[model samples]
Target chain A: MRKINSRQAGKKVPDYLENNIVRFVYLLRSEGVRIGNSEVIDALQALQYVSLENREKVKTALKATLVKKAADAVIFERCFSFFFTPPETRERLRELRQQKIARHEHQIKEAEQVFTFRGEKMNLSALDKTVYAYMPETEKKRLRDFLEMNESRETLQQWYRPFLETLVKGRLRFWHKQLHKEIQEVIAQRDTGDEELNAIRDAAAGSGYGGRTILTEDMQHITRKELPQAAALIRRMARLLATRISRRYRYSKKRRLPDLRATLRASVQFGGVPFKLKYKSCRIKKPRLLLLCDVSGSMIRYSSFVLQFIYSLNAVVQRIESFVFAENLERVTPYFQQGQDFERTMTAVVRESGQWGGGTSLHSALKALMMRYGDELTGNTTVIIVSDTRTIHHREAALELEKLREKVKEIIWLNTLPRQEWSSYTTVAAFQRSAAMFPCNTLADLEQVLSRKFLSA
Target chain B: MFVSLEKLQKGFTSAGYICDEEVILTVYLALRLEKPLLIEGPPGVGKTEMGKALARIFHTELIRLQCYEGLDENKALYEWNYQKQLLQIQAGRVEGRYGRVDGDLFSREYLLERPLLKAIQADRKVVLLVDEVDKSDSEFEAFLFEVLSDFQVSIPELGTIRARHIPIVVLTSNSERELSDGLKRRCVFLYLDFPGIEREIEIIKARVPQAGERLTAEIARAVHHIRQNQEIRKKPSIAETLDWARTLVSLNMDRLQGSTIERTLNILLKSRGDQRVFREQIGADALEKKIRSSLV
Candidate 1:
């Protein structure tokens, strides 16, 4: 084994080794591993005890000190291997590192030019510097005077009233959009060769431009061929939703109530009078879920996604009954009840129903569904209708939905159509009168509904 | 504390624990950085045993806090000595110094230290093992942020108690429940799966020295073969492999026959379902096949 005392009393290690450690930590931080300032110092000290000759030990020394999660450890291992190449490959890495530093210095200069606010002359706080980037020239002057004026500064220092007045009336959203657009323009002007900046741009593409959640934008339109990736995402969402719902139910169960009979029984041991309290605990039953999906020709893509999403949740939810409808209603719950493979079961259900590529007529389907399963709906059941109400040449069926809503605990409508398209559809406004409606035109919308409505409800 | 990774590997071998390069490096970094190493893996992978071995290797006190459902800060951290506080109050009243007893009940004299508090208050370094931390509630996991990052405990009355010597914290999890991201951010993650055939043989030799070389090798090979069947619910870990070797040596069996396998099968397989699956998958002929290939 090669032995070297890099920490020999007041002597430092070679400059190359020190730079290697710092660069490794920098690469880790950029890859989203949370490495604090103290963690860096601890890693440097840890290197003194590890053998640099053996690559495994040296890499482990960095990982065990730097990474905090098992997921992050995978990223750390990949980066450490790339950074700590053989001596022959070191020159290429050094050249890349130098190029990266030069690019970073250029980005820093651009940021300094962009963020150099005139509010510094008025002795404004650092918050004014950030707000100045989004403000027009006229507003910048107004804000400057507001900061310099004694009375306005006193009001701003109050923190509560000033904050409410400043952010109220949707001003925060306007400023946020302005700042996002300004920053995007600045970033787009830079060299696209930067991999790190490209990663950020790719991430921003999914969240929409200017960080705006446009209701008219159908962000994720599922297709038949893309079912595998959607299925995986649904399975992960199922696990999280299941844990959250069960944890909440378990928490309520643990808070026991004082039972009179139990307290009286325990009092007999203490001379007919109770000094200590005894409680009775009961388990809260999980709410049953009933899904009615519209599988018409207009809603084929959305129906498949909603069905897959609900079936994947069968692992967490004990009681789930699913039905698909176009002109007629057919219960597909038995397929899921068989515990078969997900894709096979879904394919079997789709073929057996034979409702694929059908015309829209929710009126007849709802009437048939109620006539067949009237006794199944109860106050313990949550009825969810995943559909787009294009009614076509059928009745509105608003009164039937109202009657069905009274039988169930709650009726949640996950409208696959965009919010802007709802007003154009004749039957959607009437249907919304009976059920609590939420937009489900995108994957982000579906995730939000699952977390907020299903888990919390 | 180790000269090299190989030296650490040898040190663990002498300590009767055969570890690979990853484990040795993780433990050495844990010692050098003084950060908590959170070990996660499947059940029966010797995750908890690593904590015990590290404590032994460093010759530090091992403070184990076994976590379960509804584990709270008061249970894992510190609690007040109610009876001692009452006694002190009575003494203060009898001595006519009732006014002086204010805030005295919350002092160190009336504090009963739990595993966390004891670890921080320890004069020397310690190996604090929070075993099966995933079994605990999310709130308790959140409460560990202070003790983990700053090595201190905060009480409203007693103020903060900092560590005199930073303990070597090792948290073990079987991944029964997902831990919070906040707690995961303050720890170094290490995952240990079941040992391979060669590592299993080394572990068997070190843990069960009384067993013959041929018998140990045969047991390791058979176990390696058995673990290949994914249908088996609980694969035999290193501890189970050692137990199997020791059982064979004590019974004076040189070969692994059907009767010997039948007699000591329970030592390796815990569940009846897993045993049934193993027996159905690997029958008499399969056992003979494993034994034949084990020699060469």
Candidate 2:
């Protein structure tokens, strides 16, 4: 790295500090923190105000200029320690990267080797070649012996090609399992003296799913220890949602029709000249949210997160109604409205309601909701149903959902199942007919769904 | 002007603001770079207090704009004194100077300067604190971009008005909303979390000197413990901590006993829900025991 030195506060600053700061900003951007050129420049300019002798001052100065959000601060801390602490660590990390690249290149070369059968080169698929290259020496010898024995069989000649392909595919699956296990073991053994550097490298390499940021991790796979971080991220997303909704309402409130009567009434003080115009100031109705969360065995994990999100939005939305259902629907809006802590409230709802960890009956749940809260459904209401779409009596449930859809402005189905698995579930197809379905198995998906559905409206 | 970072830290300390190195460094850079400092954190983390402290340290005026829903440019930037203009027009008709009043209607004489305009048009450097800026509409936030970037505002009648002496700008938010990327990019960002245990004790001692040293330490530890509880929705703020300390001093309590804590817990935990959680989950006796154990 080229070094540039500058004078600030009558002190000579180190040349490498600027170069390191620029690299650190890029590191932050790669870790999903947004930074622009101006911020980079600001970070550079901030260096002039602090003495480089003090490490904490330098870190703080860079942080003030480069980081904008609180959630990104944790990533910044990790990256800062990894990049700036113990100058030799950076060199060590560079060496590790080089070694990793060399290893990958060697593996690719080995995978390019062709298989031979009876002095003739056999054309193999890419999967077979990869599996052959990475497989253990013993497994390779076993495969060779098996193939050699089968090569001279005249009775099985007609069915040879299909059989060979199936055998290679089975080996490919086993190879994948082996590779995954090795990677997990490598991650588990933190041999690196610098744990922060190892963690950053692991996350960058995408080896350990647990090493990934909480925002991008799947909700169901989030461990108990990571729940607090996940909950904080959810709360931040909810806060952003509330702000967008309030801003939209405030903007629309300003564009109302002019109130000529009020204008005249005000002009009476000014000789009836109608000097100023008055707006009608009609009350803008906040969008009503009705959340129906399925607490069945399959969807219990996602429902708790969704309920926590709704609980965070309790103060912002005036007419939010929450319902959790398994075999039957139970209204839990009162629990949220009580202003108690979410943990206690969630515990009470789970214990008192008869819908905890049971089979899903969407038809009965929707029927019970309509019969009890039919008057609350209106054009302003948005019905959000969080579920896996796996329920008994799918046909009746679809019909009831369509009926509920007709009474509300829109029905948004947050399917807990991944998008690739949606096709395998017939219930997903049926539910898709009456509601706009979005796969929301992760916090990122939930944020995107909420922003697209609610903010756009 | 502060020639060194140590001087700035001392200035802030003298101003009665207990800030860490991060705060001092960020504020120093903001001052040197002439960039707006956007401070965001949870409620009552001294985001607004930092701005006030800056103004006090500099011996300048602190012009505040308390942002809320539907805040507009006219209210924040500047507004025309319409009634004065109308009176002028009526007087001009009587005096046969209608054309003169028409020219004077949009002049500086009738222009009412709000916080933004006042900060720009001040004869000396001032501190501008836009408090709870996240509460304002996005349009208002967008409107701020122009004034903040160039330190100037354009009025149709008076044309562009630039700053006489560029005032130091500090914007505070409670993280109620995410600010625009454009706005965030234009300023330096700082996040103020709750003070740590030692810092809280120092703050209590500074703000409420009547309280005994033992009492202050116990109060700080108890408050820290409560803040660590995830169940409490609204954590006790520094101001609340000081208030609790003062209450302890006035009540002549030297140490935090279980009964005294039970009686005075409401001072720190404002909401009934927070109070109930503190009682049921982390009871007064448990907290007292923890505090006493820490002391030993």
Stretches off by above 4 angstroms in model 1 are: A1-48, A66-244, A249-457, B1-11, B87-102, B258-265, B279-284, B287-291
Question: What is the per-residue lDDT of model 2 for residues B100-126, given as tens digits with 9 covering 90 to 100?
Answer: 666667799989999999999999999
lDDT of candidate 2 over A1-457, digit per residue (tens): 2233332234544557565676567667666789999999998888877677777877888899999988788777777666664535544555665576477557656544435444444556654565566678788778767776777776665446666756756776667556643434343444343333443454444434334666666688788787766776677676676676655552345647887656754664454478888887666677777888888988877765876776776755767888889999888888888766778787887778888889999999999999999977898777888889999999999999999999998898988886756866899999999899998888878776765635634
Residue-wise lDDT of candidate 1 within A157-223, one digit each (tens)?
A: 4334444334322343355445644544334433334333233333333223333333222534455
Evaluated with DockQ, which candidate comes out highest? 2
TM-score of every candidate: 0.60, 0.82
- TM-score for model 2? 0.82
